[model samples]
Target chain A: MNRFKSFVIKEFYHIFRDRRSLIVLFGIPIAQVLLFGFVITNDIRNAKIAVLDYSKDDISREITNKIVSSQYFSLAETLNNDKDIEGIFKKGRVKMVLVFENNFAHDLENTGKANIQIIADATDPNLANLLVSYLSAIIMNYTLDMNRLAVVPMQINMESRMFYNPELKSVYMFVPGVMAMILMLISAFMTSITITREKESGTMEILLVSPLRPSQIIIGKVVPYVLLSFSSAVMIILLGIFVFGMPVEGNFILLLAESLLFIILALSLGILISTIANSQQTAMLMSMVALMLPTILLSGFVFPIENMPFILQLLAHIMPPKYFIIIVKNIMLKGTGFSYVWKETLVLIFMTFFFIMLSIKKFKVRLE
Target chain B: MENQVVITSKNMIKKFGDFVANDHLNFEVYKGEIFGFLGANGAGKTTAMKILCGLLTPTSGEIFVGGFNVYTETEKIKRSIGYMSQKFSLYEDLTVFENIRFYSGIYGLSDADIKMKSNNLMDKLGLSAQRNSLISSLPLGWKQKLAFSIAIIHDPQIVFLDEPTGGVDPITRRQFWDLIYDAAHNGITVFVTTHYMDEAEYCDRISIMVDGRIEALDTPFNLMKTYNSENMDGVFLKLARA
Candidate 1:
């Protein structure tokens, strides 16, 4: 026990002495979280749009009012001629342009048909698609209300109800992702680099020559990192709850327990990486390429795994953070307990065992 | 073979696939003697030392250290012996006192025993004043000495020194030999490997290896007379050339 204490103390000294490691462990998580939450979001608001009404009629005017009042778009200009559309779009100030046919009210009253053209800048396809959807929904709702007044009805309506996040707040989604990423960085990447540093410096040979068993040595190296990652996890959760208004609807203990489990899985990954890397720089590079890329790309932290190709979706299922994100989102948004999360919990357990078994095999081979 | 042998290897072979490192060589070191093992850059002195230290297992044949077989009783042999490599493996971020305490703790020394012995060891090596200083700040010679001292801090029966004096001033080399002599005087058998012929003369008995086999083993004077050489260097060159 005294030996283990001394070993842990040495690990702490290594961590505190390296300033670069300090920043990578603590600075990266909060920066990424704030950037993803505030800077990169899908739910755009207050986009400027231009309108051209060739018809001087009540139907066209009513449709214009409905578009402006929906709050999804704003009228930046009212173009008098068709030539204005090119210049407005080229200036980049207007994201969308609307045109109404010459006899809109006459056509609607006599033939029950009116034509409107909504043209969006297709350079950013995602934004264009969202603008098209929001506008169509608003127009359809207005037409349905008009049909109710006219006695004959020919209108279609579509209502979107976002389930987990009704307000579509980006913070609700990014907070859990940021927490998983930061915990993996601190636990796996940092711990692996530290252990490989010792190996490169020859201090690991000294420790191995001593009477301490290999298991004791490994545990001693990893325990301090587990504690550090746990604290970082808590800090992110608190920031998400208090500062960003992300809900914490589930039991705090369950959230913490899942976080701890994932932290251990990441720590074992660090150990596994140390066995493969001969130098600290090599270990850091490996962690970034192997752990960070997979965690970010394949773990559904940014991109949706369901939309990926089949092979990539299979690869995503093996990523540890995928399961971790599911658990975090479930507890925070769904207020779920173990009964609801047992499948994900079991998957995490299997991944942890896989990493531990591979690391132990590598360690034994190194000992030989 | 002598009955009181501390190290005994009989046709011991170590091979990595087809490359034979220690090839069916036989040698012995008796108790309470400074035995020197010398060879050129790739003559397999390190391979033999690693096998004896329980860090590596030989490919074939029998090897024993402290009367325990390398194949079956490696952990027991590791417990009964100590090893120090030329790398001077000490944690640079740790204080001198902390390094010593850490080694002692892992070696299963009690806290009171560690404190007492660490103080006495540091005082004897004239490093008592810098006990709290980080190992990185100390000179290379001091680090080497501290590493040698810590290697045998457990008071093992035999200590293996694999080129312990690789790079240092002549003064530090002489001081390191003095520590080895001190260990010999206390009945701790010293099995050391070195390239310096002057250091070879200080050993009670010396062995020169050539192509993974010992070509000469005796007192320096006897080997010189047998080879008709003026110094140990001439003898080593002649044997290496043959």
Candidate 2:
């Protein structure tokens, strides 16, 4: 036990002594979360749009008032003719254009349906999709309110509601993804580099010939990183909750425990990397190219895995972070309990076991 | 000096697939003697040393280190041996005193023993003034000497030095031999490998390896006479050439 203590203390000396990576360790989570929260988002706030109403009726004016009253869209221009839409969109001043066809209110009352065109600029397709959805929801809400007062029982009004996040704040989605990515990169990258640094410096040979067992050495390498990755995970969660007004609807303790499990999984990946790489550079490259790329791209952190190609969907299933992100999203956003996240938690546990066993076997091969 | 064996190997062989690294090696290292392992580059000197240190298993041989079987009692063998690699293995980012203290602690030294031993070591190495200085700040020669001291900080039965004096100045090399002689006199067996022939002259007995086999094992005086050479370097050149 004392030998293990000394070994861990020595590992800390290496971490604290290297000032560059120390900064990176604490800096990445904060910077990435803030960037993802504020800069990269799908939230539609005061989206610029133009209105082209050919009817000039009270109902068309009322619907226009309703759309503009919502915080999501702001009236950027009033187009006098339909010919100006292509020109206005070419000017890039508005993300969408709201067009009401001729005799909109007359058509609505007589036929129980009206033709209103919602044109969106597809240059930034995600933002355009979001703009169209919000507009459609507003129109749907207005029609529902009208139907409640009408005496016609044969009208079919379609109503759709966004649950959990009624306002569709993008931070709610990004916080869990950022947590997954930061934990994987910090835990795996740090552990692999530390072990490979010892090998590169030739201290590993001395450690091997000493009284310390291989298990002790491998454990000592990972314990410090687990602590670091856990602390960073806490920082990200706090930022999401306090800074971005993101909610933690479920048990906070369960969320933290799950984060720790994922951290250990990443650390096991780090150990596996260290066994294969003989130099610090190779270890770092392998961790980034093998671990970080998959965690970011295939973990459903940014792109929706269901929307991916059939082969990538299969590939995403193999990524451990995909399950972690699901677990985090369920706990923080959906207000779910362990009963809901149990299958994901089991997958993470199995992956952790598999990585650790493989790394131990590989480490033994290296020793021999 | 010649008969109390601390390390014994009988017909040890290590092969990486079909390539023989230490082919049918045989030797013994006696207690309280400076035994030198001399070899050309890639002559498998490190492979044999690794086996003796219990870091590698011999392909098929009988070996004992510190009276413990290499295969069955590797942990016990490791506890009684100190190793210094060709690269200076001290943590460069740590202070001189911290490196000493860490090494002592890992060897399972008590806190009181650690405090006492590091003070004595720093003073003896004439590094009392640099206790708080990082190892990387010191000169190369000083670093080499400090690494050697740390390797034997736990007072193991035998210290294995794999080219411990590589790339150091001549004066420091002489002082390093003095430290080895002092350790031997204090009943610590020294098993060292070096490329310097003059360093071989300081060993009580030297084993010369050529092409994964020990070609000669004897006192430097006997090796000089057998090869009809004036010095250890000429004898090594003739043997390595053959």
Candidate 3:
């Protein structure tokens, strides 16, 4: 036990002593969280818009007011001529351009036939689609109100409420994803590198040649990484709570227990990786390519798994992060307990057991 | 055989898939003797040594280390033995004291015992001043010497040195043998493998392996006389050519 203590202490020394690893372990997560939260977001706010108001009428004015007041689009300029639309779009600050035809009020008053032009930048197709829908919704609402002046009519209403994240704070969603990513990196990636480092330096052979069982050697090497990953999870959670306004609504102990489980899962994965890799460089490359990228991409940390292609969706089902992210989201946002997260818990448990068993088998094969 | 024999192997064969590494090799080392297992590169000396050290499992064999069966009692065999590989097997990031503590820990030593033995070992090695220094900061000779000291930190019944003096200077090699002599004098069996023929001559008994089998096994003087050669090297060259 004393030897195990010193061995774990040596692992901690290796982790804390290296500047590049220290930065990668802690720096990237926090930076990604903050960047995803405040800088990069799906919700459009204050989008630049230009208007060509040829109608000079009450309907056009009301529609413009609604668009501006919705806070989704800001009116950047009132274009004088149709030719100026291209120049304004080329400037590229303006994402949308609205052109109201001449005699629109007269045409609507007589035959209810008025034309409106909505031009959008097709460079960013997703943003363009969103902008088109937003402008159309505003104009439709205004037209319906104007039609009410003539007669009262039955209408369809669509009422929607976003659960948990009403304001759709992207940071709230990213906090748990960041926690998973950082924990996996610090636990699995770092542990594999450190273990392979011992192997490369020939210290592992010495330990093996000693009285230590292979299981004991692996455990002693991985225990410190699990603890470090746990602390890293805690740190990310604390940063989310204090720095960002991320709320943890579920039983705090359940959340911590789940985090600990995921950390173990990642550490076991690291051990499996180290067993397969002969060098520290190979371990690092495997961790990045096999674990980190998949954890970020296929785990629904950044991309939605449901919306992925068929094969990728099938692949994402096996990624441990996908389940972990669901558990975290349920706990943090929906305030659910084990009853809600039991399925994800089972998947994590199975993955952890699978990885650990695979690693033990691989280690035994190496001893042969 | 109460401490009479340190290691015994009969028809030991280590096969990886279809390739046999230690092919039906028979060997034994007596207690309190320096038995050198000699071989050229890839001659399976390391493979045979690994089996004796409980690091590798033989496919079909009867192997015993310190009178304990290797297949079922590897742990017991491991506790009774120590090993230093071709690469000096010390954690370079750790201090000399830390490395000693680490090895002793795997052997399940108490803190007080580790403290006591480390001091005595360092004093005997003339490395008392370098105890607190990292192994990386030490010279090649010191690292090699320190590796040997830490290998036997638990004071095992036998120590396996696998080319322990691979890259050290001739002076260091002589000093390393002094340490080996010290271990042998303490009634510890020294089972070593080396490519250096002169080092083989210093052993009480030496086995020369070529092509995965022991081509010759006898005392250095007896092997030279049996082969009608002047030195151990001449005998090795003759066996290697054969």
Candidate 4:
């Protein structure tokens, strides 16, 4: 036990004595949280757009005022001629162009319908789609208000409610994702690099030749990283709560317990990686390519898994972070309890056990 | 001289998918003796040493280190022996004192014992002033010596050095031999593998391995007389050429 304690202390010395990794350890979580929170968001604010008002009527003017006042858009240029709309869009100063057809008010008054053409830059399809939807909603609201007194024969009222995130704040989605990503990065990447560093530096040979069992050595090497990753998880959670106004609606203790389970899963994956990698560079490359990319792309962190193709959806199911993100989202946002996340927790536990067993078998084979 | 053997191996064979690394090797190392294991690159010297150090399991062998079976009692063998690899095994980021303390502590040394031993070790190596310095900042020779010292910090019955002086200057290598001599004199068996031929002359009994087989095993004087060579290097050249 004393030997294990000393071994753990040695591992800590390796971590704390290296100033650069220390910065990466503490610096990355805060930077990622703040970056994903304030920057790198889907919430469109003040999108630049040009208005081509050909109608020159109070209704067109009022619609333009509505778009501008909604805070989702800011008018960059107002065009008179139809040719100017193309020029404004080509200059890239605006992301969208709202064209009000000539005699818009006259048509609405006589036929109860008017044409409003929305020309958006589809270079970014997602942002373009969002902008068009926002513009259409504002115009639809105007028409509804204008014809409020005229009773329709049959009308179906569709009231859509976004549970947990009523305003659809992007930070609510990102906080859980950032937590998954940061924990995966720190736990898997850092642990793999550290263990492979021993192999590269030949210290692993010395450790193996000592009285300590290989399992003891691995556990000792991993304990420090587990603690570090747990702290990083805490830092991300605290940042999410205080800085991004994210709420921990579920049991806080359960959330932390699940986070620790994910950390152990990542750590075991790291050990498995280090077992296959002979050098630190190889270990780092493997972790980044195998763990980080999948965690970011396929874990439902940045992309919705349901929207992906069948094959990619199948691939996303294999990623540990996908289920972890689900658990975190449910616990933090919906305030769900153990029953809601037990299946995910079990999968994480199984994965951790599988990786640990695989790594131990690989490590023993390597020694032989 | 009391020729009490501390290490014994009979027909030791290590195979990696039909490529035999230690092919039916047999040798014995006596207590308080410096046994030199000489080999060319890929000559299986490291393979044999690793098995003895409990780092590898031989496919078939009857091996003993410090009277403990290498198969069933590997942990005991590990505790009874110390090892230093060719790559200096000290953590380059750690201070000299810390490295010593860490190794000693892992070997189950008490806190007060570690303090006293590390202090004495630093003073003995004339590195008291640089005790707090990182291992990377030290010269290669100092690092090699310090690694050797840490390898034996627990005072094991046998210490294995895998080319301990690979990159050191000749003078430093000579000084390192003095430390080995001191350890041997204190009843610790030294099993060292090296490519340096002159180092073979310092061993009481040397075994030269060529392609997983012990091609020659004897004292330097007897080996010289048997090979009809003037120096250990000439003997090695003749055997290698043959």
Q: Give the B-chain TM-score of model 2.
A: 0.98
Q: Is the docking of candidate 3 incorrect, acceptable, medium or high quality?
A: medium
Tell me candidate 3's fraction of native contacts, as a decimal between 0 and 1.
0.72
RMSD of each: 2.8, 1.8, 2.5, 1.8
User: TM-scores for chain A, candidates in order?
Assistant: 0.93, 0.94, 0.92, 0.96
DockQ values of all predictions: 0.54, 0.84, 0.64, 0.83
Q: In candidate 3, what are the lDDT values of residues B86-128, reduced to their tens digit?
A: 7997777778887887778778899899999999989987889
Candidate 1 docking class: medium
Clashes of 2: 0
Q: Tens digit of lDDT per residue, candidate 3, span A1-368?
A: 66667767777766676787778777876787677767877788999999999988987888888999999999999998999989988989699999989988889888877999999999999999989987887888787777667764676755457799887777887888888888888889988998898899887887887776787788888887777677778888888889888899998899999999999999999999999999999999999999999998999988889899999999999999889999999998899989989999999999999999999999888777
lDDT string for model 4 (A33-152, tens) is: 899999999998899999898898999999999999899999999988888877877889999999999899999888878999999999899999999988888887877787677765
- Decide which is better by DockQ, 3 or 4: 4
lDDT per model vs. reference:
0.87, 0.92, 0.87, 0.91
Q: Is candidate 1 or candidate 3 better by lDDT?
A: 1
DockQ category of candidate 2: high
- What is the Å distance of residue B70 in model 2 from its true position? 0.8
Give lDDT for model 2.
Answer: 0.92
Q: How do the residues A1-368 of candidate 1 rate in per-residue lDDT, one tens digit apiece? A: 87788778877877787787678767777787778878888776878899999997998999999899877889999998999999999999899999998999999999988899999998999889989988887888888888878887444555678887887787887888888888888999988988898788777776666667778888998998888889889989988888788887788999999999999999999999999999988999999999888988988988999999999999999889999999999999988888899899998888899999999999988876
